[model samples]
Every structure is written in C-alpha cells, then in structure tokens.
Target: MKKMNKAEIQLLHNSIQAEAIEAMQKISEADSVWRCAYEKAPDELPPQEETEKLALLHHDFMTALTLLAVLEKTMPRNSTRESLLILSYEMFKLTCPNTFERFGCEDILKSVATLLDSIPTPEMLTAGSIDKSVHMIAKAAQYLPKIPIVPKEETPTAATVTVAKDKGKEVNINVGLHAAFAPIVPRLTVFDLSVMQAAASIYASGSKTFSTNQLYRVLTGADAHTRITSKATLEAVRKSLDTLQATIITIDAEQQAALGKYRRYDWNETTFKGYLLPMTKIETAYYSGNQLTAKCDCWRIIDTPPLLAYSKTIKQVATIPQKVKRLPRGVSATVNNICIRDTLLYYIQLNRDKGAKLNYSTLFEAAGVDTSDRISRHRMRKAVKALLQHWQEIGFIADQTDVIESSKNDTIYIS
Candidate 1:
C-alpha cells in the first residue's frame, strides 16, 4: 500500500469534518422533532410513527461521530485540521448534550483531546500507520458507550440460581457463577468477539497457534458452516485482526484482583497499570504475491488477565444444563450492531432453561444501562429484539412458542 499524500490526507479530513457538521445539524433538527413529539420530555419515547425517523437520526449521528474519530488520527499534530476536529467535537457536545450524556461521550472526548494535545507532529505518515490507526479508531468508536462504571460489591463466593416460568414449565437461571462474576472489560465488536471465540476454540483444542486464514474462516462463519472462497473477505478479516490488536481495554480493581493469583506481573504499574489489549500479541506473514500466508503466536483468554477471569467464570457454570448459545456465522457478522450483546448473552446464559422469566429492568441495571433515559431504553429494546431475531436465525431458539414477554410495567419474561 502506498502512503497518502498531504493533499489526500487533507481531503479525507475535510470529508470527515463535513460529515461531523451535518451530524450536528441533524441532531439539532432531531431535538426539535423530539420536543414536538414528546413535549420536552426527553425520557419519553416518541410516538410510533416518528420512532423510525428518530432512530435514523441517531444512526446518522453515530456514523458521523465514528468517521470524525478516524479523522482525529489522520491529521498532523498541532495543525489546523486538529483544531477543526476539536471544534467539531465541542460543537457536538454543546449541540447535543442529552445525546452525549445518554451515550457517555464526555470522558471519551476528554481523553481524545488530551491525546491530541500530547501527540507531536509526524513528518509523514506511512500507509501502514494510517491504516492501523483508522482500524483502531473505527473499532473503538463502536464500544465507547458500552463500558459500564463498576459498582461497589463484594467478590462472589458461590453460584446463585433462580427459577422462572417459560410456557408453564420450570427453568433454572444461575446468577452467582463466574459468568456473572467476570469483570467488565471493554465492549467488543462482533469481529472482536469472533476473533476471541476463534482463539478460545484453538486453545480448547490444545493448540496455542493459528494462521490468519484460519481465523478469517472462523470469523466469516465459513470454517464452521459454509465454504469461504472470496479472497476479499479473507483480506478484510485479516485487516480487522490488525485493527483488533490495536484496540486497548482497561481493567478495574476488582478485575485485577480476579487475575492477580494467575499471572506474574512484569509491566509497570502506573503507566501500564490496568491497560491491556484483547489479544496479547498477533503477527502476520505475507507472501511475494501480497497474500497473507500465516498468523502465529496469537494469544487470548489464558494470556490476557481479564479474559482469563471471564473464561474461568464461564467454566465454573459449565454444569448448567443449557449453556450460553454460540453465535452462528450469519449472526456473528453483525453482532457489533447490537450494543448490548454481552448483557443479552448473560440473560440467555442464565435463563436458557424452560419457562425462564427475566426482569427487563434488572437486566438493564446489570448491563449498566440507565432505563430512565428514553434513548437508552429505545436502544435496549432494539438490541434485545435484534438479539432474539439472530438467535432464531442461528437456531439457538427453534420453537416459535419460545418468546420474550414484556409487561407494561417494564419486566421481560423469557418463555
């Protein structure tokens, strides 16, 4: 790949800025529509007729924000482009305070600004450098709001099981196991999850190594179901892994405790403290034909502390009759879009037995979502609906009678 010229880079930056401006304008318009629809009640859902429009507006805003985040990386340090990017970010916050609050964008914006201020100007960015940063930013953008503030709670000592009704049949949902105890890590996109799953599978099979092509097949679902023949898709998956490795996740104090007994520490506590990537390391090899030949020494779960705790927690609950459903290839492809995939999986894992009743508000609280916010509620509803649809498509829930029952009082029962 060739390096991007200054002109080309500036063009990209301008395009991103234009999109950001448009997103801010649309958000302002949407606020007016929202007020008209809900009489200034930000906590109330818009009428059914206007819901789709509102959702589209939200989507546009997020897409633009994502692009803007990428542009942050492409610009030179202390340049006019950087100043404009900062202005756009501040404008979004000022124009859409509620939106920012709902999505928890304040800390992220502050951190990005700090990072921009510290970066020294680079003479020239290579193609590899630009691609890697773009990939990392794109992946990071999807997960910004998903990180939950850890609550004060004692470490769990035993599994807690609850019973619920599904079609008048009794079902068991375990709440006190390692699955529920695992510390919250950075929210992972579907591709990230798929890569982790692939690594887990490889580790489970008594192997510590896999090729990039092998991972590509697993991610696209071709390895488990269909045959993946397209080189383009494979190349895309390879690129995604490169991006995935660049993404970092921070672990909390509780999470650190969970892993303290397992691994010996070598990195610095202050600078490297609590910060780790999902994959410990990834290396790819290319051929003379510019094709990816192999990937080696990719480590996860066992290698990463937080993942180790999470994996251990899952194992502790292995005795549960109905295990957490695995994502099928078709479902895995779009899992990133469902912002609450982790929460949804937790619900399913705990309530997979017959006649399971899950409280909607409780699940939302567990997922660190504020149900009081109308937009957050709306996103949760859509995420749950998408999760169920995907579960059925992947045959995780085969019976048409197995439905999610929602009450007017905000409770969800799984039957």
Candidate 2:
C-alpha cells in the first residue's frame, strides 16, 4: 500500500467531483427525456393509461445514479467509482435482477466513477475539507467491502383460461376471463358510479359492446377526465363510480362554453343540441324557449379547497388591467347592448332562484317586468339575441338560442 501526499489527494478529489457533475447532468437529461417520452409520445401506446409508475421508476434510477456520482466525486479516485457502481449493481441484483440486465454493465460503472472523479476540488484549508475527505473515504470503504446479489423471486406463470361447452345445452353463456385466471387478473380500482353511468349510457345507446379499453377512452374523455382515478386500467374503471359520486359540483354552462372554444366548428343543430342538454344520466329535463334554462340540481365535480389558498395566489397576480381607463370612452356603446346585458343578468339571477322549470311569464314577473307589452317583448327578443352574440364572442356561452319552446305561452326556453 502507498500513502499519497496532500497535493495528490486534492487532485484525486477534484477528478472525482468532476465525475459526479457529469453523472448528475446526464441523469437529469435522461429524466427529462423519459418524461417527454411518457407524456408527449402516444406512439403504439394506450392513450388512457397512466405512465406515472414508469415515470417514478425513471426518477428513482436517475436519483440513485446522481447519488452514486456525488459519492464518487467526493471520495478518492482510486476505487470510489468502482465501489459505488458495485453497490448499485448489487442493489439491483437483489431487488430487480431482470431490470439490471437491461442497463447494468462494467463499462457504465467505470464511466460513472470516472465522471465523478473529474469535478474540480476547492483548495486545501477551505471550509470543512478534512470532514469532507473523511466522509468520502468512509463512504467508499463502506460500500467497497461487499457487493450483494439478491436471489431472484419466482415469478408466477401466466394463467390460462379454459372454455368448455356444457353437454346437452343449446345455449353457451359467456364466462369471464378473470373467473378462470383469478390470480393473474391484476387487481383493479373499485368501480365508479359516474363511469358506470357513462358506461351504461353508452351501452344503452347501442354503441359496440363496451370493452375495458373503450371504457378507459370514454373515462379519459373531456366530460369524464376529472373523474378518473388509479393507474391500473381495471382499478381506474372500478373507481369511476366513486370519482363520479365525489363530483358533486356540476360544471356550469359557462365552463362548458369555455371548454367548447378550444374546438372549432360551425354552429349547427347537432352541436347545439349537445350544448343545450346536461349529461344524459340526469333524471328529467324541461322546456324553455327564449332565456337560458340552467338545471339547479347541477352536481359538484371537484372538492372545493379553502378559498384563501386560491385567493392569495390571485392577489399576487398583477391587476394593472383593472386600473386601466375604460376603453377610451367611445370604442363601443349601445343602449340595446346595455339594456339587454342588464336584462340577461336579471333573468339569470331570477332563473337561478326560480329553477330551470320556470315559465317566461313567471320569470318576467320575478324580474318585476310586464310580460304583455308587444314592443317590450320585441325589445327583449332583440336584447336576448345581442346577449347571445356577446356570450358567443367571449366563448362563455354555447349555442345561445337552443330553445325548447313552450306550446302554452309561445315563449322560448334557452336550454
């Protein structure tokens, strides 16, 4: 054994630190790449699947790689990298030998060590040099002595499904694959009611028979996106009902309208129909001809967290626009627009209180306005159209004139 001088030790430390720096940079880059691949690329992979597990695995691998690199850099160059690499390999061998087979190699280990050894070291007599040296040497010594290789756990063989026809029976009822291969049918999240509703509705509509995959896609759809839970496909489906149950806060027409603006299309009757109706599972619906009819039983979607948490964040945002002078006073102005805007707001408030089933006369009475004046009715109609146009402009209203007309009073219900 040879003892090195202070200068030689310092040179070794600098080299090792360089190696650590390189390893950290590479691991970070790899982490980002894996994330992008997981999130952005849909190539040949299931869209509805959650890639979180793979992401976490990638993260852990990178983290371990980083720690090893740092340990190598801080330790002496002679055997520091080799020892860390050995420890990593041994750990993988114990826990996941098959996974280690994919990426673990002598060259990679050696390179990792070399990279850690290349970082620049501070001049001697700086803060805590002796402590750092002692720590590095101790760490290197600790890992160098033993390299563990974990015994492989026996993986269960794939379960087989058998189908046999009952003797002397004309009919053959379908049997579940899980019934035959119970152990292999990976545990799924509990079934969710909302997902059940969506599935039931889909099934009723006579769309092709539902599969776990199709259901997954539907749950991932815009209407059900927030309701999905769990990483396992089956488990996520099972949890769909619970997620839907929790979604008590119904998404209002305004939010629906906001969601619609992201997609472009002509204002046709079909799309208008979709915008007017609430989701299919609702028990009953009513007719409203002119004014928008919002369902009062609108369900909740997300859990309402404390307002203060959000309010502080909002306050932090710059409010310079609020201080800006009104649109140069004459950019736009009209009595019809103003009156109609006020009227719409009035009607909205009244409808909110009165429920979606309110008739035009009832609404007018609620607003303290006369329902009989022909001229007033004409003005109101014009105002309604203008309000619709404004809602359209701001992407805050879907098809505004989707009126379910009332036969008794010849009034329109804006659904």
TM-score of each: 0.33, 0.18
212-308 in candidate 2: lDDT tens per residue? 3334434332121232233464455534433333221111112112233312422111111111011212121121213433221111111111111
Clashes, model 2: 39
Off by over 4 Å in 2: 1-15, 18-22, 25-34, 37-99, 112-415
Query: Given candidate 2, what's the lDDT at residue 164?
Result: 20
> Candidate 1 residues 115-136, lDDT tens each?
2332212221110111000011
lDDT of 2 at 244: 32
lDDT over C-alpha atoms for residue 170 of model 1: 38
User: Considering only N, C-alpha and C atoms within 3 Å, which residue pairs clash in candidate 1?
Assistant: 160-176, 165-355, 166-355, 178-313
